[model samples]
Target: MKTVAVIDYGMGNLHSASKALEHVADRNTRVVVTCDPETILQADRVVLPGVGAIRDCMAEIRRRGVDDVVRQVVASERPLLGICVGMQVMLNHSEENGGVECLGLMSGNVKFFGRNLKDAAGNKLKVPHMGWSMVDQHQPHALWQGIEKNARFYFVHSYHAHAVDDEVAVGRCDYGVNFDVALAKGTVFAVQFHPEKSAANGLRLLENFLQWSP
Candidate 1:
C-alpha cells in the first residue's frame, strides 16, 4: 500500500484533488493538508496541488520549510505529481506575479498563454484555456495509463509550463497555441489539467498514477 501525501500549503484545491486520488489509488493515502515539513518528507508518494500564483505557492512551501523536503522527494526518485499551478511550480522559473523563482525541478520557464496568438480564422482566442480540453499525447507515460490519445480532460489555467527537453513533455494541448499538457521526468510527473474534475478519464488517469511503479 502506498501512502500518498496530498501536499497542502493552503494554496491549492486540496479537497477535490484528494477525493479524486482516493477513488483511484485505493491504497493507503493521506491528504496531508498540513504545513509540517516532516509530514511531506515521510510520505511514500507526494501530490502537490496548486491553484494560485507561483510566487505565493513557493512562499507557502518556504514558510513551512518543506522546500528542501520537496527537493528530497524529487531526488529520492519517489512519485511526485503536481497539478495546475502545482505543475507550474515544477519549472525553473515563472513569469507570474512580476516573475518569481520556482523549484527548478524541471528546466523550463512558465509563461502566460496568448503570448503566441495564432491566426485562427482571422480571430484571436482567449487566454486561460478553460473547460474540458483534449490532451495531445507526445509519448507513452504511466500518468496517461488507460487514457486514450487525445482524450478530453478538464482544464482551467492561464500560465503553462514549457519543458526544455521535449522528451520530458508527455502530453500537450492546443489552446490558442500548443503547450506542454503533462510532463514526466525521472520520478516527477505533472499535469496542467484537473483530473479530479475530468470525470471517468480523469479517474482512470489517477488510478494509473496509483498503480504506477518506478
Candidate 2:
C-alpha cells in the first residue's frame, strides 16, 4: 500500500490537511500525520504543511528534527509537497520575523507584500493577501494535471516566494503584484496557497499529487 506522511512539526493545521488527504486518497493508500523521522523517510510521499510564522515554524521544524527528514525525502527523489509557510521555509531566507534564514533547498527569497500596495483600481490591498486568487499556470507540470488553467486557489499569506530563476515557477498569482504561487523542481512541488481550503480545484491538485510520479 502507498503511504503518505504529513510531517507534523507542531505548526500547520494538521487535522484539516490530513483529513483532506484522507478524503482524496485511495482505499489502499494510508495517510499518516506524524513527526517520526523514520515514518516520514519511509513513506511513499511527504507533505510539509505550515500555517504560522516562519520563525516559529523553522524553530519547531529544527527542534523536532523534521528538517533533516525533509532534506532526506527531497534527496530520495520521492515526491514532496510543501504548503504555505512550509513552502516559504524552503527558500534561502524569509523577510518575515525581520528576515529569518530558511532551509535554502531552493534558490529564492521570501518577501513580504509591502503595506503600500494597491489593486489596479487603486484600492488599498490587504497585508495578508487573504481570500481566493486565480492561479496562472506558468508551465506544464505533473501537479497541474487535472487542475484547470487560471483556477482560483485559497491564499492567506503576507510573504511570497521569489525564485532566483524564473524557470522554477510553475504557477503565478497576482495580489497587487505578480508573484510565484507555485514552484516545481525535480520531485519537489510547493505552493503558497492552501489546497485543502481551496475547494474543488484544491482537492484536485492534492489528488493529482497523490498519483504524480515525478
Candidate 3:
C-alpha cells in the first residue's frame, strides 16, 4: 500500500490535514500522522503542515529529528509538500518570532505583510489576511492539472515568503502587495494557504500530491 506521512511536529493542523488527505486518497493508500523519522523516511510522500509561529515550529521539528528527515526527503527527490507555516519554514529565514533561521531548502526569506495593509481599492486589510483569495497559477504543474487558473484558495497568514529566484513561485496572490502563496523547487512544493480548509480546489491539490511522482 502507498503511504503518505503527514509529519506531526506538534505545530501543524494535524487532524484537518490528515483527514483531508485520507478523504481524497485512494483506498489502497495509507495516511499516517506521526513524528517518527522511520515512518516518515519510509513513506511514499511527506507532508509538512503547520499553523503557528516559525520559532516554535522549528524547535519541535528539530527536537523530534523531523528536520533531518525533511532534508532527506528533498535530497531523495521524493514528493514533499509544505502547507502554511510549513511552507514558511522551508525558506532561509523568517522575520516572525523576532526572526528565526529556517531549513534553507529554498533560497528565500519570510516577511510580515506589514501592520497597515490595503487592497488595490484602498480598503484596509487585516493582519492575518484571513479568508479566501484568488490565486494566479504562473506555471503549468501537474498539481495544477484539474484546478482552474486564477482559482481561489484559503489563506490565513501574516508572513509571506520572498523567493530569491523568480521561477520558485508557481502561484501568487494579491492582498495589498503581490506575494508568493505557492512555491516549488526541485522535489518540494509548499503553499502559504491551507489546502485542507480550502474546499474543492484544496482537495484536488492534495489528490494530485498523492499521485505525484516527483
Candidate 2 stretches with Cα past 4 Å from truth are none
Clashes per candidate (backbone, < 3 Å): 0, 0, 0
Q: Give the range where candidate 2 is weakest over 10 consecutive residues by summed lDDT.
A: 139-148
Clash pairs (backbone) in predicted model 2: none
TM-score of each: 0.93, 0.98, 0.98
Model 3 residue pairs with clashes: none
Q: Identify the superior model by lDDT, candidate 1 or candidate 3.
A: 3
Cα RMSD for candidates in order: 1.8, 0.8, 0.8
- Best-first order by TM-score: 2, 3, 1
Query: Which stretches of candidate 3 lie above 4 Å from their native place?
Result: none
State candidate 1's TM-score.
Answer: 0.93
Among all windows of 10 consecutive residues in model 1, the one with the lowest summed lDDT is 26-35
lDDT by residue (92-131, candidate 3, tens digit) is 9999999999999999999999988988888998998899
Stronger candidate by TM-score (1 vs 3): 3
Query: What lDDT does each candidate get?
Result: 0.83, 0.92, 0.92
